[model samples]
Target: MKKIALCAAALIAAIPAASFAQEADSTEATAPDGTRAFGIEPYIGIMGGYDSYDKRSEFGSPRGGKMNGALIQGVAGVNVPIGPAFVGVEGNVAKGFGDIDWEYGVKGRVGARAGESGMIYASGGYEWVNGKRAYSDQKDWIYGVGVEVGPKDIGLGGVTGNSGVRLRFEVDTYDFDSIRPMAGAVVHF
Candidate 1:
């Protein structure tokens, strides 16, 4: 668990350096409207939802077990605008409560701008689950949809999209069997 957390931190720290590795192309610096086109985003959010084991007991009980609780997560990713659309890759670590202990995953998103400072996207990823049950093959593929409503660029003045605080909401399913919904704020760099 510590190793996974440390790796996530290291990956976040490395993105800035990766961005600097290449010489800045004029196009990479700003969008058509002259706002910053690319940057690193670090987000923290409250994750709440239910986890159920595939097999159920006779009384419809969790064959193995189930967890109903909220967890916290920290995610870091990079975003770049391509015309009216944006692309991003993110990695996250989560600590669960109740019957769940931990989860980690990486995801990719491709979406278009929603109005001026907002975005709507669809994402898919692979996640690993650590539950109280002694189960094998806890890793599975997940898919979900989400949206971000950022603070109006109008209020930020100066650069249109250099930075802003965004409200994010999303829901994902592990192996099409269990669901996890999350919401919170994201800080753009």
Candidate 2:
């Protein structure tokens, strides 16, 4: 009878410890940082760079020129994981150069986390630009490659859940004759 009582006591003591171990394992797996590994992140960003339009002659005079300007883009997108790489789609609106244009695209990137602070990624996307000009309205496809570096915890406040920055550089082209480099920064959510 004493042996049975002691066995019961040992089992009762082990129960709480076993429960604690399970709780601790779950906590480590479902932590906030771990949850950020993949998701949709809507962000607002600004880009400042040179823009060059194809030289077209209107009424026998050169009309397109290269200029420096600032652009504001709003992005809504999701990041998906494939093994060690990530793929995403972004729908964006860019307003600049006295006009507003709509761009929707898909981006593919290979990236890894940097400690507990941020991630570094190299990405490329295909974008379709549609808008009007002084002469007429047009649509074109632009392909580019770029790099982005930003915080791991991207949320309402910022990179650290308060305020953080994202940077990108891309060279986009509509045709062989029209290629331009663009760079910009975004205050991530």
Candidate 3:
């Protein structure tokens, strides 16, 4: 029975790997059609945002009202390009003011390239929110959608050709319990 279970698990794993695999290509920086050659792109950025907790949120204030705060965060991630689409993993740490103490999370992103060097993506992740001692700490699943616009997309192609810098804006929900809006810039390499 153990051997049978092991074989079944192996098959389940191999099936997805087999479907995504493709014929190998030469190790060149850019493909013939002018897209990125098969490689990983790593990025880092800083953002500032606001979080508004639902009135019914577990992290309520001592006065029995909703809690809200401003936050600053640093993020890092790596993306694997697959043709015009890509998949990535990202992590972030944030410091909060007002009723919040700290927030941190890790998420997975998937999206497609848009308009020269821009991207539109969706992300889902797990987050931990720490509140001031007067409030409670909570952890939940978060979901977001965001866009990144590169120099070329924003009409700076002549001066900053492929500079690997982008402007990002996103909105996220904290377990359908809070609203978060953030904007920032990211540099990729």
Candidate 4:
């Protein structure tokens, strides 16, 4: 939707001004070697996965009244590290195959650092989904938990150290209406 895109753009544009207004402090994110992490890290990635709906009737069945399909998505977000923990906001737009048409959402994440550049976090947000014209569109609240392991933690530190790339895995519920699982890679800057 135009509104969603505009809102996400506004949020991303405001990050720098907001972050710079804050004074540097000891609470800032730090690496294992005691160096400060990027004050505000912005990232983007592409993910692919599946979405299974709980109510087949609402989504219209392409296969024996069963509503489910594969999805590919684009993701973007920013993280602010605070000591060993971090907080961030992310936005995603997805295209679906089979019974689904499209999906989009925005979420907020909060969690602690895991092994060098890795992170362990939980997220919640609002999502809008569109299915085959067999039914009306739907929107709901979504919640999930995920992890991101940097190349260094995965044993690529020697080659990709500070490259800002990480592997991400996540699972979320569409307001208890559906189960969604996704995985991808993200690069921060």
Candidate 5:
């Protein structure tokens, strides 16, 4: 409960900062093609990260430790572009390391885009943690912030031949205690 409260507080505190970012990017919030980002972006990608577990009150058994590995997850979401701001809801499923065999969640995100090249956003969601231990599966909330930068945004336009392709990096906390950091490639179209 403490972790959830902290995450909620942090997200609430970030609202003003997100507003400032949107205001700054309002003058130029288009993609490279001079159009706002839109549509249902369904993407499949692989994510590798370190998963840390809570030491205290993490269940009565202290057998399973932290896991460091990768998980392949599929994400599908729709983005509503409102001038320089964007809002979206996404759902994902992943299989990974440690006592965590698999997990799934749905998240909502809001952010500001700097042209079509990149975006910075904050997200929170409800997740089900599928642990390897019997009776270890649990439900909880997760929150995090992330940034996406595309090839077009970084002066790699002609070479990458990529539209809506972006690099994703984020650090998310689950069960209000476990932290998982992930990075992957995705396309918005």
Candidate 6:
């Protein structure tokens, strides 16, 4: 009887070890080569924070105010793999409101993914806004770096599909002294 009990314990331990090995094998099999063959991911997000405006002698005095607002964006782009690197572009539209004022703009970003699920990346592009129009212009450049966390098959072809949340921190120099942090989610199809 004692021998049988010992055998049962040994079997249970072996079962867990086998299961772990299977999981590791599957992860390696599905490992992304940093490329997305084809996919359509549309995301909508909101950003809120503060903006510090450098006093332009020609414009007036230095003014800093609370910057909090919402943005609705649609992204249409492709994920490509260059060796172990992942590159992609996204077209976006943003509408914002805050103490500084209200404005909207269209922008695009080009970035690479490193570490599983692009745990980190740097993206930069241009933005055109129409509203109170700070700096006596209609638009400007928007660029920043951010970190993302998700699954390795996020944009890869798979049966389970890609669905996860993303958070980004960005600083735009278009307005002389405007820094913003944005957080949002993405649904890949």
Q: What TM-score goes with each of the models?
A: 0.66, 0.50, 0.81, 0.79, 0.76, 0.52
Q: Write the per-residue lDDT of candidate 6 for residues 68-129, one digit (tens) a residue.
A: 33444444444443333334565655554533343444444334345555535444456554
Give per-residue CA lDDT, model 3, range 89-112, as digits (tens).
Answer: 999999999888999999888776
Q: Candidate 4: misplaced stretches above 4 Å?
A: 1-29, 33-38, 56-64
Model 4 pairs in collision: none
> Which digits, one per residue and each the tens of the lDDT, describe model 1 over residues 12-84?
4455445544536444654434466654444544444444444431112335554444678777787766544
Indicate the TM-score of model 6: 0.52
Error of 3 at 87 (Å): 0.5
Q: Count the backbone clashes (under 3 Å) in each candidate.
A: 0, 5, 0, 0, 0, 0
RMSD to truth, every model: 9.0, 17.9, 6.7, 7.0, 4.3, 16.6
Write down the TM-score for model 5: 0.76
Ranking by TM-score: 3, 4, 5, 1, 6, 2
How high is the CA lDDT of each candidate model? 0.63, 0.46, 0.81, 0.78, 0.69, 0.45
The TM-score that candidate 3 achieves is 0.81
Q: Per-residue error at 94 for model 6, in Å?
A: 2.1
Q: For residues 1-78, write the lDDT of model 5, one tens digit per residue.
A: 757666775675466456546656455554444565444445555556666666553533555544334566767777
Give lDDT tens digits, candidate 2, residues 37-103: 3355455566655445555422011344432234555555554532223445555555645432443
Alpha carbon deviation, residue 9, candidate 3 (Å): 23
Residue pairs in clash, model 6: none
lDDT of 4 by residue, 1-189 (tens): 445644654564456346534635555645453546557878999999999987554565555565678999999999887655667999999999987899999998877678878888877789998887564588877877899988878789899867788999999888766788999999988
Candidate with better lDDT, 1 vs 2: 1
